[model samples]
Target: MKLYWSSRSPFVRKVMVFAHECGLAERIVCVRTVVAMTKPNVDLLPVNPTGKIPTLLLDDGSALYDSAVICEYLDSLHGGPRLFPESGPARWTALRRHALGNNLTDNLMLWRNETLRPQPQQSPEILAAFELKVRNAVAALEHEAAALAADPVSIGHVAIACALGYIDFRFAALDWRTGHDRIARWYETFARRPSMVLTAHVDQ
Candidate 1:
């Protein structure tokens, strides 16, 4: 398997973290690919029309994009407790947390793009809205951190951690730990996981 990867992408980190947990990290060959929303990378166009990173080129000659799908696929290949529960309430909870995490990350990334735009083209209103959204999301996580911290490690946990990591990497000025004490404390330990320690995001 081949993965079009970017060290700076949290989405890519999710997949890599999943791979590491599943003990399949050594099997995939990572091909570094630079990509930006406004500036597309031609090399990725042939394989993934969206020119996205973390695109998986499977050995069977097929491809899979999106961290959610790729992580589930990798989880399926493993034998231990599934990152994605196969059914019932556990499945729903995992999916819900995972979605919330992804959504939080999406808004943050968009907020970041807005900041990168020329000052004249940037929308202060949009940035403010997302900043509020992130604050509320972190507040909600503070309530759930105690439970999430005591886990067998679900894919949802992976998503949430990656989302938080992205904030620290790009929006450090936000200081997300302000009042979300439990979540902050939990993250202090979660961030030390070998998978996270190894795949820590890098700007360049």
Candidate 2:
């Protein structure tokens, strides 16, 4: 398998982390590519119509993408330490947390993009709405994450870790760590994991 990878994409990092965690890292090859939403690489269109990072090309030339699906596929290669739990409310909880974390990431990205626009072209209303979503989502995660502090290595946990790291990467000025002490503590320990340490983000 070959991964159309990028060092700066948190989504790509998520898949790579899962593969390493599941011991499938050696089986996959990384092929670096750059895609910009504002001006996507046309060459990558065939690989992924959406021109997204972390697209996985299989031996048969089949392609799969979007980090969540790639991570789930990698998990299947190993016998059930399942990053996504099977059966019961645990599955729902993990899925919910994953969705929320993804939303947090999306909102943060939106906020960053808004900031990048020229002052005259930027939409203050859109920026404020996205920022509010970021705050609310972080607060919600902090509250729920505190309850799941005992076992903090599920899929949802991974999503939360990536979301927090992305904020540091692009929204450092937001200083989300101020009142969310529990989440901050959780991330401090989570970021120390081998997977995270190995894939720590460095500016391109």
Candidate 3:
């Protein structure tokens, strides 16, 4: 499999982290694909019209886009314990956590884009809203920190870790760890995992 990847994209890092956890990292060939909201990758449009990184190309000329979808596919290929729970309450909890984490990542990316604009073009209202939402999300994660630490690793954990990692990588000025000790502690350990250590973001 070939993955359209970017060292700077949190979503791509999420998929890469998931692949590593699934013990399928070696099977993937990471292609450095550059994409931006303002400038789409024309070459990537053939495979993924959205021109997103983390688009996986299968051996049979098929493709899968979206980190979550690609992660589900990777999970299917692994025979060990599943990151996505198969059924019942565990499944629901993991899915909910994944949604929370993934949405946080979305908000962070949007906030970043807004910040990247020229000062004259930037929207203070949008930036303030993103900041408030991020704070709320972090507070929610803090409440779930103990549960996250107790549960076996899941896609939810991966998503949350990636979101936090993105925050550290891009929004360090926010100093999110100041008051969120529990979640910060959880992430400190989670970030040490080989999957995360291997996929740490690079400005390039």
Q: Which regions in candidate 1 have their CA more than 4 angstroms from the true location?
A: none
TM-scores of the candidates are: 0.97, 0.95, 0.99
What lDDT would candidate 3 get against the real structure? 0.96
Best by TM-score: 3
Candidate that beats the other on lDDT, 1 or 3, i.e. the better one: 3
Summarize candidate 3's per-residue lDDT along 95-117 as a digit string, tens digits.
Answer: 99999989999999999999999
lDDT of 1 by residue, 1-204 (tens): 999998999999999998988888999998889999999999889889878878999999989998898999999888888989888887887898899889999999999999999999988899899999999999999998988887668888889999999999999999999988999998888899998998999888
Give the residue spans of candidate 3 off by over 4 A.
none
Candidate 3, residue 188: how far the Cα is off, in Å: 0.4
- State the TM-score for model 2: 0.95
Q: Give the candidate number with the greatest lDDT.
A: 3
**Full-model lDDT, candidate 2:** 0.83
**lDDT for 81 (candidate 3):** 96
Clashes of each: 0, 0, 0
For candidate 1, give the lDDT: 0.91
